[model samples]
Target: MAKFKYIDHGQGGAPACMTLAEREWEQPAGRQVLIQVAYAGINRPDCLQRAGAYPPPPGASPYLGLEVAGRIVAIGPDVRGRKVGDEVCALTPGGGYAEYALADERHCLPVPKGMDLLAAACVPENYFTVWTNVFDRARLAKGEKFLVHGGSSGIGLTAIQLAHAFGAEVWTTVGNEEKAQACRKAGADHVILYKEQDFEDAIKAGTGKQGVDVILDMVGGDYINRNIRSLAVNGRLVQIAFLQGSKAQIDATPIMVKRLNFTGSTLRPRSDEDKGLIAQALAEKVVPLMEQGKCLPVIHKVFPLAEAAQAHALMESSQHIGKIALKVQE
Candidate 1:
């Protein structure tokens, strides 16, 4: 049996726990394709998994990493559209940190024209989450006002660009001026310094108490109530993660009075078919924008596969303004 190198976090602790290790290779099965990974994206969920807070779904690989960009080297019997030597980016079911990984053929997407593997590696996790939650679940529409918390994050920047491209007004909350500028450069109409000013107050004052039409938030806890209060009459609030804390004491009055929609989702646990649909949507709608240099991913840093610990440290420090990736092949 062949072996490949991957990041291993024994018993799951801090970023320091991750180390390069070798694992026996497994052949592609079912509709899966084996990818010779060139790059793997570093996401928040990957950190959570390393810390033992988030666990992989049943039947999913227990390793870290949710997305990768590479060339398809082998395909299972049921694979049809993908084949050997095809360059693609994929949303993996886990184990993206390895030199090679397995991905459902339906969840793999062609690398956008003129985009490199590094940028392609950053696309699947952020794009799929933003598309499904902000558009499919929240029903964001053209000309509406939109706001996203953590403006400098990969997800935040993606939402800002996509919403602005689709003709919606974009607002975002950032920790500092640097992130604010980054968000503005990404097409945000309003950038609020969450540290210097109250987001709810800013929203209330900016819109004359009308609030925004939709808000995509990852910081839960107390922000939940403020998110509820900082909405227009028919506004929608989509929660993706709880960086602060999941448990919140929020008033239910606003939920009923405003006719608001409060919803959210996690990408890794979703069915393969659901992720395939999202991939199809991205290929049809967003890939053209990427080809035209619109709504492209912003990469802040890239580390060699062995330095995954340093990458995770940078991510947890919340200092980077865009996506982080690990170079797996070269």
Candidate 2:
């Protein structure tokens, strides 16, 4: 037994699955390494897991958090090169809300120079999702026009900066002036006040009615149909989440006439081999930018690990502009 705590909401109770309890963890297995977590990143999926809406994938740990950064405390026999005490940020198979977590060695990245564990913690989930959707799935190229909805969100901010850094002309929708400035500072060419303007009209006007090349969307609902209208011919709309809602009554005419493609993915359920590919791609394409301070994560706040419930409250409040993190250890 050790001084380890983890979030478990599976047991039936008042908050049921969102409860925090002490637990001892076994050593890493196969290519996995056990990490003494310093900080864990909060995400929408964590909130869903709390409410028992999103369950961990088969064979994954039954904990809430998805990503963490810390020192590697131990390594399994199959792991190579990486040794105990390596400073790393890793995408986990859940269980990041604890003092310790295990991750595949292939999924770990060195913490960039001048970055703390908190910033590193904020990187994995959002960056992995953005890279998988915006670049791999959407295939956004240099000089392409890209639009991101929910521009102030954890994943939205990362998408904005990454698209911009990759030489795309980025456009985004924000709720207020503060969020607008944040996106603008992240190199967005245009910030649509989603509350005050029709985003479809804004996209049309901003692109001279040509529409955008790709759209990275998390806001679903009517925006689904509107997203089709906002894309140019042969455009892609990658839906990563349905924050507003899903199940939209959309017209097929626009999709057919425009030759548009609609795709959606949830990263948690992806295979380890698939995630390892993403990890390698990120190491090559994105890590250098991170080292140079481009596409760095925008952290909104950091809550102590004991206050995991409060962290979820802030995420649901939708008031934060970027990633919310949990300080899990020293």
Candidate 3:
């Protein structure tokens, strides 16, 4: 079978300038299932990796995609809970941007009942991210206030909805009025226009100067100090990415003063066992939410696989309000 592959990284030029071509794919190995990918969701990590800033961990596949939804075409020996023709969504270590992708059994999540395969593709990356970093690491709980940056992003939108689903008051920052409305629709109690208002000030005012209970911060650098200031007593800040820049000069006083916890995680580098625990939790906890219509995947656009360049362009534009997906089937 033919699959799309990341042929090279383009450091100084546009993402489209980097090569993507169809290539012959091999069959699955032991404990691995070969997925006939129906749809693949594009994420920020894919873009960073393409720019040669982030490379896959040692021994990981060279292909560049983090999530996919499709049917299992072949199952390796010792794999359980799945069979050929079973529809599933999976967190890929790599090789997701292709017609056929291999996934270890632990990383696979079953497609929610009554959900379309394309829509299911959007669920794994965002849900796994929020579940691991926000709920598991930060220990966010009911009745707490949660604030997220880039509320219109795939990760942000998912976090807003899930935090609201589990009884937290949610707030988010967005680039424009349109995205702010989108955030509100996704269950954010308040939306701050980050380009206009200082988010720390707006959040403090919204909370009556009490600050939020947890902050899901993707922006680093200058946002670090303010994020500490925007937290309640014993608050938690979970960092998933540093879109602005990672290095920063900041005071540690707020963290010590407020007893705030600052931490973050990336899914790719984690062990298979850890990812399995997360997958199991998501399948039991979050999948029911989607089945009951309490939470769902939001797609900003779906481009044909051949238009992968355009899909990356749209995501890079920072204008899309939700997940951008690549359609593998007509």
TM-score of each model, paired residue for residue: 0.99, 0.97, 0.95
**All models: lDDT?**
0.95, 0.90, 0.87
Writing each residue's lDDT as its tens digit, candidate 1 over 1-330 gives 989999999899999999999999889999999999999999999999999999888988999999999999999989989999999999999999999999999999999999999999999999999999998998999999999999899999999999999999999999999899999999999999988999989999999999999999999999999999999998999999999999997898998999999998999989999999999999999999999999999999999999999999999999999999999986
The CA lDDT at 314 in model 1 is 99
- What candidate 2 gets wrong by more than 4 Å, as runs, is 10-17
- Rank order (by TM-score, best first): 1, 2, 3
lDDT of 3 by residue, 155-218 (tens): 9999999999999999999989999999999999999998899998898788999999999989
Candidate 1 weakest lDDT stretch, 10 residues: 261-270
Q: Clashing pairs in model 2?
A: 9-17, 9-18, 10-17
For candidate 3, what's the RMSD? 1.8
Candidate 2: lDDT of 247? Answer: 89
The clash count of every prediction, one per candidate, is 0, 3, 0
Expressed as tens digits, the lDDT of each residue in 68-164 for candidate 2 is 9999999999999589989999999989999999999988989988888999999999999999999999999999999999899989899999999
